[model samples]
Target: MSTAAVTDKRHSTLRAASLPRWTPWVIAAGSLVLGIGISMAAGLDSQVQWGLIAAVLFVLGTFGVAARVEGRRQAKDRVATSLVWVAFLLAVVPLVSLIWVTVVRGVKVLDVYFLTHSMGVVADTEPGGGIYHAIIGSLEQVGLATLIGAPIGVLTAIYLVEYGRGRLAKAVTFFVDVMTGIPSIVAGLFILSLMLIFEMQPFGFAGSLALAILMMPVVVRSTEEMLKLVPNELREASLALGVPKWRTILKVVLPTSVGGITTGIMLAVARIAGETAPVLLLVFGNPFINNNPFEGAQASLPLYIYQQFANSAGSGAAFDRAWAASLTLIAFVMILNLVARGIARWKAPKTGR
Candidate 1:
C-alpha cells in the first residue's frame, strides 16, 4: 500500500468512537429496574437500600460497558465522574429528608397563634402555647453574645495578623486553637463554674457569655483568614503615603476585606444561635415570657425545643411544638446566612470604577 493509504488507515484506527449522549441515562434506568427487582426478590423494604443497590449497579455497569466500548482510560474517567455524582447524592439525601420531615411535622403547629402567644398558663400536653418567649430570649442572648464577641474577635484577629509577634502572639494563637475545638457543653460548664463562684443564677446573659466563648474563636479564625487575604500591597501603598500604621489597617486593609469580615461574623453568629447545650445550662429555660435577659431565667429557641420534647412526656402536642421550634430555628439560621451574603455583596470592595 502507498503512504497515503497507510496514513488514512492509521488515522481511522486512532480516532475514538463516541457513545450516544443518552447512553448513561439508559444504563441508569436499566440499573434501577434491576436493583428494584433484586430488592423485591430479597424482601428488602427500605427505599434507601434499593437506591444504594441501584447506585452501585449503575457505577459498575457504566465501568464495564465503557471499558468494553470506549477504552480503559475512558472507563476510569466515567467511574470517577459516577463516584462524584454518587457522593453528592449521598450527602444531599439526608439533608433533603431532614428538611422534608421538618416541614411536614412542623407545619402542624406552626401557625400565627403559635408564633404570637407563649406557654404562659398552658401545659405542654394541652397544645395552646407559642414560641414568643423563646424568640425574645434567643434574640437577646444571641445579640448580647454578638455584641460582646464580634469586636473582641475582630480586634484579636487584627492583632494576630498585623502586629502579633513572639511568645504572646503564639500563646494567643494556641489558646484560640484550643478554644475552637472546645465542646459547647464545655463552654457552658466553664460559665457554670463562674456562676457557681459568683453565686449567680441562670439568665440570658449567662448563655450569652458561654456563646461568646464559642463565637470568639470562630470569629477570630474567620476574620484572621479574611484579613490575611487582603493584599499587603494595599498596606504598603497606604504607608508610603505617610499614613499611620493603624490608619492604614483601618482604611486600606479592613475596607478591602470588610465583606469577608462581615460574612465571618454572621457565620459565627449562626454557629452560636443553634447551640442547645449552652443555652440549657446557662439560661435554665423558663416557660413564661421574660423580656429582661439580664435578670431572670430565659427561654431560648433551642432550649424551648428541648423542654417541649422533654416535658411533653410523649404528648403529640409537645412533639409538634418541638418540630415547629426546630423549623423556626432553621429559618433563623437561614436568614442570618442570607443576610451575611447580602452584606458581603453590598460591602464588597468596588473595582474597575
Candidate 2:
C-alpha cells in the first residue's frame, strides 16, 4: 500500500476500536454482583444492607476496572456519574414503598364515623368505634399549639436574624439549639414536672403547652433562615423612603418572607402534631369528648392510636382504628402544607425586578 493509503487504514482501525459510551455503566452493573458476593460473605442480616453494599462496591470496582482497561480518566468519570443515578433510584424506591403501604393499609378503615366518633364505647376489637373524640382533641390541641408557638417562634427568629447580636443572641441561639435537640420524652417530663410544681393535674391544655415547647425552636430556626434569605435591598429601599425601621420590617421584610415563615410554622406544626409521649404524659385520653382543654382529660390522635394498639378487644378493629387515625393525622398535615402554599402564593410580595 502507498503511505497515504496506509494512514487511511490506521484511522479506520482507531475509529472502529472506540468503545461505546455505555460500556462503563455496563461494567458498573456487573460489579454489583461481585459486591453482593462480598456482602454475603460478610454475613450481614439485612437485605437492604447487602444491596447497598453491593451497589457501592460495584461502582468502585467498575471505576477502577474501567479506568485501567480504557487507560483514560474520562472512562472512570462516566462510570461514577452513572452510579450516582443508580444510587438515587435505590433511595427513592424505599420511600415511595413506605408511603404506599401507609396509605393502602390506613384507607381501608376510613369513614365518617372514623372522623367523628371517639373510641370510648368501642372495645379494642369492636367493629364500630370511631375516632371522633381523638380527632377533635388533636385539632383542638394542635390549634392551640399553633396559636401559642407561632408567635414565639417568629419573634425569636426575628431577633436572631434581625436585631440579635453579641452575647445575648449567642446565648439565645444556643438555648434554642439545645431545645431543638431535647428528647420528646424530656419535654413531656419537663411539662409534667412544671404542672406538678404548680399543683396542677394533667389536662389537654397542659399537653398543648408541651407541644408548643417542642414546636417553638423548630419554628424559630426555620423562620430565621427564611428571614435571612430576604434581600437587604428591600429593607434598605424602605428605609430610603424615610419609613421607620419597625414599619419597614413589618411591611417590607415580613411580607417578602411571609411564604417561607408560614411554611416553617406549618412544618413545626407537623412535627409536634404526631408526638405521643407528651400528650400521653400531659393529657390522658378520655372516653368522652372534653371541649374544655383546661379542666379535664381529652382524647388526642396519637394517644388514641396507642390505646387502641395496646389494647386487645373483640376483633382486629383496634388496629384498623389506629391505622385510620394515622391516616387522618397524615391528611391533616398534608392539608396544612397545602394551606401554607396557598397563603405563601397569595401573600407573597410582587417582586419588582
Candidate 3:
C-alpha cells in the first residue's frame, strides 16, 4: 500500500528472478561426465555401459541444475515430469517399430493376385501366388463364428443383466471369468472332441464352433457391462408409460445399448480372428480354395502362415506372407474399431431441452 512497501515487493520479485537458468544445464553436464567416468572405471561392456552412463549422468545433471536454479521442490517436479515423458517414449517406441516393420514388409508382398488365389498351385519356385482361398476361408469361418457366438453371447448377457440375480448371476459371472482365461488350445480340443463324439468330422464348421466358444464369454461380458451402463431411469420411464417389460427392453433398452453391443461384437471378432489352434485342429488347412465351410477343410490366414513357415521350400515366401497377413489383420481390427466408434457416435442419445 505504501510506496516504500510496494517498491520493496517489486525489488524482492526481481531479486528472486536473478538466478541463472543455465545452472541445471551445467549440473546435468557434470553428472553425465561423472556417470561416464564410473562406467569406464567399472570396465562395463561398451553398449550397456555407455547407455547406463549416459542415462544416469543425464538424470543427475537434470536434478543438479534444477535444484540449483529452481530449488529442491521444483527440481524434483521437473525431474519427475521428464522421467514420465521418457517412460512414455519407451512404451511408444515398440508399437511404432512394430507398425513400421509390418507396413514395410507387408506392402512388398501385397498385390491383387495375392487377394484372389490359394497356395495350392503356387510352387515355392514361383513368386506370384495369392492368398485368395485363405482370405475366403477366414471370412467364412469367422462369419459363422460371429453368427453362432453373437446370439448366445447377447442372450446370455441379456439374461445376466435383466433376469439374473444372486446365485445364478454370480455363477455366470464366475464361469465367464474362468472361460476368459481358458487356453485357446483347450477350446479347440473341446470342440474337436465333441465333433469326434458326434461323428461330425473336422471341418471349418467345427473351427467356427470352437471360435464361437472362445468369443462368447468375451461378448457376454462386454455386452453385460454396456447393458448395465444403460440408465435405469429410461427403463423406469418406459415402464411408467405402461410399456411391457419385454417391449421396453426391445424398444428402448436394446436401442440404447446397441452401439456398445456392436462394439463388443467387433471386439470379440477381432479377438478370435487370428486364433490358430482351433482352426489348425478343427478345420485343417487345405491348399485348394474351399468356399464351402461345412463340406471340407479350409485354409485360414493363420494356418496359411503356419504352413508356409513350416515348409522349408516356401519359408521365405511364407514369412513375407505372414507379415503381410499380420498387417491385414491389424488393418481389419482398426477398421472395425473405427466403425464401432462411428456407430456409437450415431446412436448416442439425442440431448436437447
Identify the leading candidate in terms of lDDT.
1
Error of 3 at 223 (Å): 1.2
lDDT (10s digit) by residue, model 3, range 221-282: 98998888888899999999999999998998899999889988988898898898889999
Best prediction by TM-score: 1
Clash pairs, candidate 1, are none
Off by over 4 Å in 3: 1-61, 67-79, 198-200, 312-315, 349-353
Worst 10 residues of 1 by lDDT: 1-10
In order, what is each prediction's RMSD in angstroms?
Answer: 4.3, 6.4, 6.0
Per-residue lDDT, model 3, residue 191, is 86
Clashes of each: 0, 4, 2
Question: What TM-score do all the candidates reach, one by one?
Answer: 0.91, 0.81, 0.80
**Alpha-carbon runs more than 4 Å astray in model 1:** 1-18, 313-315, 349-353
Give lDDT tens digits, candidate 1, residues 148-226.
9999999999999999999999999999999999999999999999999999989999999999999999999999988
In model 2, residue pairs whose N, Cα or C atoms come closer than 3 Å (at least 3 residues apart or on different chains), thus clashing, are: 116-132, 117-132, 125-314, 125-315
Better of 1 and 3 by lDDT: 1
For model 3, the run of ten residues with the poorest summed lDDT: 1-10
Q: Model 2, range 1-353, lDDT digits (tens) per residue?
A: 11222235333332221346677667666767776777788887777777777677666766676555544454556566767877797989798877787688788889886776766666666677788888788888988998999999999999888899999999999999999998888989998999889988778998998899999999999888888888889899999999998898799888889888988898789878889999999998987888888888898988988887787452387777777777888888788888877877776655555
Error of 1 at 289 (Å): 1.0
C-alpha displacement of 266 in model 3, angstroms? 0.8
